[model samples]
Target chain A: MFWRETYIVFRRQLRMALRNPAWVIIGLVQPILYLVLFGPLLEPIAGQLGAQNAYTLFVPGLLVQLGLFGALFAGFGLIAEWRAGVIEAERVTPASRTALLLGRILRDVLQLFVQGIVLIGLAFLFGLTGSILGMVFGLILTVLLGAACAAASNALALTTKSEDVMAPVLNSIALPVLLLSGILLPMTIGPQWLQVVSDFMPTKYIVNAIRELFTGDFFTITTMWGVIWTIVLFAAGLYVGTRTFRKENA
Target chain B: MIHARGLARTFAGRGRGKEKEEVKAVAGVDIDVEKGEIVGFLGPNGAGKTTTLRMLTTLLKPTAGTATVAGFDVATQSQEVRRSIGYVSQSGSTSPEARAGEEIMDHGMLYGISQKQAEARGRELFEQLDLDGLWTREPRAMSGGQRRRLDIAMGLVHDPTLVFLDEPTTGLDPQARANLWTHISDLRVRLGSTVFLTTHYLDEADALCDRILVIDHGSIVASDTPDALKRQISGDLVELVVTDAAQAGAAAELLARIADTGVDTDTTSVSARVRGAGHEIPGLIRALDAASIELESIEVRRPTLDDVFLTLTGRSLREDA
Candidate 1:
């Protein structure tokens, strides 16, 4: 019954997404810009990192970045729904609270993957190539990470109940997390202290894991740590999201 | 059907540096509603009508006491209560971007109705609510009245035994309000559902409700049929606007002998409640003529729900709102 409602809600949202093509286009612009403008600048360092193509090294971080930035902003739409009484209307229904949330977060995950695939296709056109297995693994990690962020973002938005506070707080946290995750450059090439700091950032595990997967080192320690951290983050995010949703509806 | 006893809701007050205080919004409200009846929950703004409705609908937990909506405990068996009841919130529930028909259908689907059944139900509601052509339009593209009709349609799609509407016609014009009132009045007749609604419009309550519950502060100040409540004030209202400003006091004094309460006198006006409205007008005219007060005009008016509220709370409902 719960899954049925979740699927129904998922389909409704997907239909809305299809109706609003501008959102999809806007979601694609940032990742495509990175592939177009920033991919070529890293070619000199590509040889130093022992990679024939710099696009392969850059694409993984961009995928994680896509998920991180994309999911963290999902709450803006929810806040609008809250103000419009859509959330209140849903609360008065017999639908499970878990389903209400799972449906929305699942939509965000699907959006991330679709846009991630678009970014990957653009990378291919720009001369980026990698093991198909590695690319799929990276895409999977990004979706999971995006789902976790989207869930946490929704919880915060509900608590604060204001876009004014949510926007700045998310930016403050997102920028530092992005920088420390080494999306622009690998942390290993930076100072030892900076690398130590990056170890504490959860996205660093994801970035390193995706980079390994991009290089076809799927069975390595990086892959194990990446999967474990992503799982832990996803669990925490789902727990927070579900609890907040239940409390709000209750 | 709905029954609530001592239902109360309190929220932690916003405090800075001092101890937090609890603001009691719905304080010990008791209500009894029979099946197939339309009851209007009337109150001034901030008088806790919406809070009481929320508690009854199981959206907000009561701080104290208990209630049963549609025979299900609002506090314990909330899901059962929700399944049996539909709610139209103060803000219309339709999403601005969603087409009216699809949104109503989706609302039914949320309550476990099949797509084909929900669509059929949606069409039935649209026809009934006079929202036939609006199915393809988004709520934002429709007028305020159309949106409210869609809200009612959404609430009724599941065919619940009871429906709760919070200020269903607060912001509409008179014609739109009248149109919505007709549909609301038909709820009990067409579906055999109990309609519980809250509104600040006294005429809306008087025209549509079988009984009205008046809330002031946090408690229910009065509850009865609109006519019965009006009759509670005693005697018909009389207003006279005399030509002689100085003689108004004398006319008021003369009318006081037959007036049930003390006559109210302004510069050139005197008004009071008098028994036997049909018989008292002549004597009042004669008395004023005898005093040579020079009558301008006189009106004998029946007591309205507002008069009943004014008598009980010492304030007009309009000003209170």
Candidate 2:
């Protein structure tokens, strides 16, 4: 029954997203623009600096950026629903609280998966090719990371109860994670303290995991650690988000 | 079908730095609704009618009290209570994106109806509520009355034993309100669903409800059948419609001299509460004639629920904002 309700909510969210075609176009356009402009600008510098597969390096960073953006927008959807009175309507229904939270997080995961696939296709066009198995691993990692960030965003949204608060809160967290998670630069080149701080950021793990997969260096223990971090972040996000959501509803 | 005693709810004030003050939305109150009966809960704004309904429906917890809905305790057996009762809030429940038929079916499915059975029940209710032709249309495309009827249809699609309607007809026009009353009466007769409804319209209670509970300031002040309530204030209502303000005042003074009775005067009319209206009419007319006040029209009628409400509460049922 819970799965059924979750699926129903998922379908509803997809339909609503599809209805606003401009948002989809806008969301898709941003990362594609970054991929087109930044990919070539950094290619020569990366190779001259002895970075392995400059295009491949850029792919993971773009994917992490897109994941964070997708997760932040997903949180905005919750605030919009509250303002529209849809959340209150759903609360009075018999839908399980757990299912509602799961459905929202899964929708974010799916959105991030779409964004990741589009970026990967762009990477292929730019002469960045990887094993099919490697691409599949990259996609899975992107979804897990997206789900974690989305869950955290939802937790913040529920606690604050205002979209004005949500927008700034997401930007403050997301921008720093994007800048410091070795998305645009390798941790080896960054300051030592910055590298240590990146160790605690979930996006850093995602970027590392995706980077290793694309370079065919997938057997490293860092990859396993990245997956473990993804799992831990996902679980923590779900726990905190669901608890706050239930409290807000109550 | 429903019983509540000592029910109370308090909401803590907002923000971190502010003192934690609790506003009692619902004070200690007791109510009972029997099977297959329509009970109208009458109250003005801020009278705690909606708050009490929310608690009984399990949407809000009572800070103090014990209550059972459909034989299930509201506190501990909330799920069971929720399953057995349907709640139609003051805010309409129809989603703008959902078509009427689909919305009803979704609610039925959530209540555990099988796919086949839910579709069948949805169709039955749609036709019964005269919404068969509009089933394919979304709520945004429908009229207010159509949407309100669809809301009622969705609530009944689950076949709950009891239903709570909070100001169900507040936004509806007269014709739509009448149509909703017809549907409500049919539900009682066909499905035997006990209805616990709240409304500000006294005539609605008189025409539809088997009993009425008048609440004020978080307390129930009066409870009885509409007729019994009106009889409690048994007296004659004498309405003297005059031509101008001067004549109205003169008529009021004449009626005052005739008897020590309750009197109310408006811009162009004077009304008096008198015992034995037939006998008092001649004396009243003679007094008015002596005062040189010309009466354009006079009406003598039995007390109505409005008068009963006024007598019990010292306030009009329809409050002016």
Candidate 2 — what's its lDDT? 0.79
Per-residue lDDT for B1-321 in model 1, tens only? 898999999989899998999999988988999999999998778899988988888788999999989999998899999899999998778768878888888889999999999999999999999988888899989998989989889889999999999999989998999998889989988999899999877778888999999998899999888878766687888888889798888888888888997899989889899877779888878888887889889888876656777988888878846
Worst 10 residues of 2 chain A by lDDT: A83-92
Give the alpha carbon lDDT tens digit for every residue of A44-157 in model 1.
878887678898789999999999998999998788778877788888998998898899898899999999999988889888877888999899999999999999998888
lDDT of 2 by residue, B1-321 (tens): 988899998778675898888887778889998899999998778889988988888778889999999999988987788788888777676567656776677667666676678789888988988888887788889988888778777777778899888888888899999988998888889898899999987778877899999888788999999877766675677888987787887788776654437678998888877767889889888877887788889998765545766889887767742
Could you give the CAPRI-style class of model 1? medium
Per-candidate TM-scores read 0.89, 0.83
- The complex in candidate 1 yields a DockQ of 0.54
Model number with the top TM-score: 1
Candidate 2 lDDT score at position B149: 77
By lDDT, who's the top model here? 1
